[model samples]
Structure formats: C-alpha cells, structure tokens
Target: MESIAIFVDVQNVYYTTRQAFGRRFDYNALWAKLSQSYRIDIARAYAISSTDPKQRQFHHILRGIGFNVQLKPFIQRLDGSAKGDWDVGLALDVYETANSVDRIVLISGDGDFQVLVERIQQRFNTKVTVAGVRSLTANNLIQAADDYIEIDSDLLIGQ
Candidate 1:
C-alpha cells in the first residue's frame, strides 16, 4: 500500500462547510474512505485551543478517530479580530513529511496553501490531493493539487 500523510485545517474546513453546505465535515467517513486505499502514516488535525466543553469534546472525538489534534491558543485582538492560524506550522510539517510519504492529503479551501502544494510536488515528487468545498476553494489551489476531492454531502455530517 502507498503511504500517505493527512493534514486537516479544522477551522477552515468547519467554516467553509458550514458556509457552503450548512453541515459539518465527516472525518470518520474521510478516514474510512482513505484508509482503504492508503497506508495512513500520519494524520494531524490543526485547531484552535478552546475551553468550551463542546470544543473539548470535539477534540476528544478527533483523537478517537486516530488523529493527532494539534492546538494553538485562540487570540482575541483588541481590534475585534481574532487570530489562530496554522499555515506556517502546517506547511513546515507537510514539507518535512513529503519525502517519506507517497501522497499528502490536505483538507482546506484556503488559497494560501497553493504555493506549498506546488512546491512539495515539484521538490519531493509527492502527490498532493486537496479536499475542499468546490464553491469556496480557490481556483489556483485546485489547479496546483495532483487531485482534488470535492467536499459534498458524502463527506458531510448527517448526510
């Protein structure tokens, strides 16, 4: 079986799915679907740390699904904006893991990751599969990826 590394941008996915489909992404379904075809070497879900009971419970659920839930403290700025980005960290990890894995699966619609996807594929000769909401995902990102998985009802909760 081919080795694969998975990275989930939890915040991006949550917001995009809710915005586009009014539903949550089904991680379990994604796991089951991918596992059949690939040897999952590493799975990481990046999220913002929260004290909310629901958030904690969600994190626990992700852990139960075999993901390493990485959290960064949520920052509330005085300007009324908040910050909890994992782009840099995620990019670094993916770059490092690229050589070891045959493919990298990134779950996010953020256009910022386009460069990272392109670079890793070119430098490491690794296949990059991007899974995101088609309506919300950037065109450049979709073009950069080796394969694109549209996040539809099949990948959403209660579908």
Candidate 2:
C-alpha cells in the first residue's frame, strides 16, 4: 500500500468542530484510523503557540500521537490582527512532498485550500482528502478533495 501524509490545520479543525458539532475531538483515534488505512509517512499538525498552558499540553499530546507538530508562534499584530503562519508553511510542505507521497490528507474547514488541492492534483496526481466537520465545510474545498472525512462523534470518539 502507498503511504499517506496527513496535513492538519489545527485551530481550523478545532474551532469548526466545536462550533458545528459541540463535541470534543479525539485526535489519537482519528490519527490511528488514518495510520491503519495507509503506510502514513507524514502526519503534520500545525498550530500556533499560545501562553495558555493547556494549549501547550495539547501540542505535546499531538507530538506523542506520532504527528510532526509544527509550532509557529502566534503573532498578534499591533493593528489588532492575529496572523496564522501555518498556511504558507503547509503549502510549502505540500509542494515539496506531494510528489514523494502517494496520498495527502488535509484537515481543515478553510475554503482557501481549494486552489492548493487543485494544483496538487493537476501537477502530481496525488490523491487528496479533506477531513473536517461537515457543517462548516466549504463546498469548493469539499469538491476539490478526492475524499472527505467528517470528523464527528463517531470518528472522534471511535464509535
């Protein structure tokens, strides 16, 4: 079987799942399922570092779960804008590794990834899958993906 690489937009999935389903995510279970389905060369989860101790612990848990935890400091702009630094990093990682990996699994509800998915598919013919809570998912993102996994109670809770 070909190897699969999972690229996760941490806060994107975290916030959306909370808003749409009102349930907590089971990261370990979800990762386990993905690993079982594929050789799983890469599992990168992107998150911004926060002063919050709990957030730090969450990051630790992700690392313990076999994911490459990419931590970028959360930059709060003077103009009251909060910057998300991972999108570009994720894109770069995807561009660099898409050809080497057989499948790319994206975890985000953000619609901006439609272009990324299209480009990867057009250029590399890599199977791209998106995992997000169904309610908040953008139609374009969903359509661009080869498969969609709605991480809900059944998925998170391992039901």
Candidate 3:
C-alpha cells in the first residue's frame, strides 16, 4: 500500500463548507474512504483554540478519528480583526514529513499553498492531492496539484 499523509486546515474547511453547503464535514467518512487505498502515515488537523465547549468536543472527535489535532492560539486584534491561521505551520509540517510519506492529501482551498504544493512535488517527488470545495478552491491550486478531490455532499456530516 502507498504511504500517505493528510493535512487539514480546519478553519478554512469549516467556514467554506458551512457557507457553501450549510453542513459540517464528515471526517469519519473521509477517513474510511481514504484508508482503503493508502496507509495513512500522518493525519493532522490544524485548528485555532477558541476554548468553546463545542470546539473542544470537536477536537476530541478528530482525535477519535485518528488525527493529531494541532491547535493555535486565537488572537483578536485591537482593530477588531482576528488572527488564527495555520498555513505556515501546516507547510512546515508537510515539508518536514515529506520524506516519510509517498503522497500528501492537503485538505484546504487556500491558494497560498500552490507554490508549496508545486515545490513538494518537484523536490520530493511526492504526489499531492488537493481536496476542497470546487467553487471556493483556488484555480491555481487545483491546477498545481497532482490530483484534486472536489468536496461534495458525500463528505458532509449533516445538512
């Protein structure tokens, strides 16, 4: 079986899916679907700590599904804007873990990762599968990835 790693941008996916489909992502279903064809060497989900009971419960649920839930401190600026992004962290993790896995499955629609994806594929010779909601995902990212998995109804937790 091929070795694989999964990196999920929790906030991006959560917001995008909620806005586009009015539902939650089904991680249980995703794990089941991916495990059949690959030996998942890494399954990490990046999230911002909100300290909400529901958010904590969701993090626990991700752990139950075999993901290493990484949390970043949520920061609210004086300007009334919030800052909590795991793009750099996620990229670093992917870069460091590249040698161990044969393929990477990045679950985010952020276009900023296009260069990183290209670099990983070119330098490490790894296959990158970009999974995101079609309408929300960046065109450059979709084109750069070795494969793209469109997020649809099947991957949603609830309607």
Candidate 4:
C-alpha cells in the first residue's frame, strides 16, 4: 500500500487558532483524524527552538507523540531582524517524500503553501490536502489544495 506523509507547522496552527478562533489546539485529536484519513507512514512537525527551555520540552513532546521532529534554532540578524523559516524545510521534505506517498497532508493555514501544493499535485499526482480550521484559512490555499478538511467541529472525540 502506498503511504501518506503528514507535515505540520505547529506554530502556524497555534497562532491562527489563538488569533481567530480562540480555541486551544488539541494536537492529539488532530493527529488522530489525519491518521484516520491516510496511511501516514511518515509524520513530521517542523519547529524552531528559542532560548526558552519550554521550546526544548515541546520538541520532546512532539517526539513522544510519534512524529519525527526537525528543530531549527532561532537566528537573529544583525539588522535587528529575527529569522526562522520552516516553509523551506516543509517543502523540501514534501518533495522528497512525494514519490513514495499516495497522499500528502499539510496541517497548516498559511496561504503561502499554495504554490507547494500545486507543485506536489502536478508533479507527483499526489493527492494534496490542507487540513485547517474553517474561517481561519485563506481562500487561495483551499483552492489550490486537491482536497480540504475544515476542522471546525469536535473531531477530537473519535468522530
């Protein structure tokens, strides 16, 4: 059987939910739903590590939750700018895994992923879906996705 790959941008989901819906993310619940939909042979969460100890612990939590965690250290530019880019990592992983997977599930709300989604579908013929909360997502992103799941309800209760 062909496998599925799940790529999550954790910070993006958290900030979008906090800013738009005010609901705390239930990652376990979300993961359950995604697994139910796809074979999910590879699961990854890309995160940035700051000086804070909590960030390190969060990375562990992700590993404990059965995801391959990729950590990028937070870099501060001399021009008084902070930089952390998970998009590049996410896209590269998706591309690398696309040939092996039947489907690619991206757990993020960033509209910027539209291009990557398009490329994945056109090149690999992989079914691409953007699983995100309703009303908190970009229209263009949804349009670009081959399929979409708007997690607007209590999908956490094994529903």
- Per-structure clash totals for the candidates: 0, 0, 0, 0
Say which prediction, candidate 2 or candidate 4, comes out ahead on lDDT: 2
Can you write out model 1's per-residue Cα lDDT over 1-159, one digit (the tens) per residue?
989999999999999999998899999999999999999999999999999999999999999999999999999999999999999999998999999999999999999999999999999999999999999999999999999999999999974
Each model's lDDT comes to: 0.96, 0.86, 0.95, 0.81
Clashing pairs in 1: none
Over 1-159, each residue of candidate 3 has an lDDT whose tens digit, in order, gives: 999999999999999999999999999988998999999999999999877999999999999999999999999999999899999999999988887899999999999999999999999999999999999999999999999999999999866
Model 2 score (lDDT)? 0.86
Query: Where does model 4 exceed 4 Å of error?
Result: 153-159
Candidate 2 lDDT at 143 equals 96
Q: What TM-score number comes out for model 1?
A: 0.98
Strongest candidate by lDDT: 1
For candidate 3, the 10 contiguous residues with the lowest summed lDDT are 150-159
Candidate 2 regions exceeding 4 Å error are 157-159
Candidate 3 has what TM-score? 0.98
Please provide, for model 2 over 50-140, each residue's C-alpha lDDT reduced to its tens digit, 9 standing for 90 to 100. 8899998988988998888899988889999989668889888987889999999999878998999999999999989998888898989
Each prediction's RMSD to truth: 0.8, 1.7, 0.7, 2.7
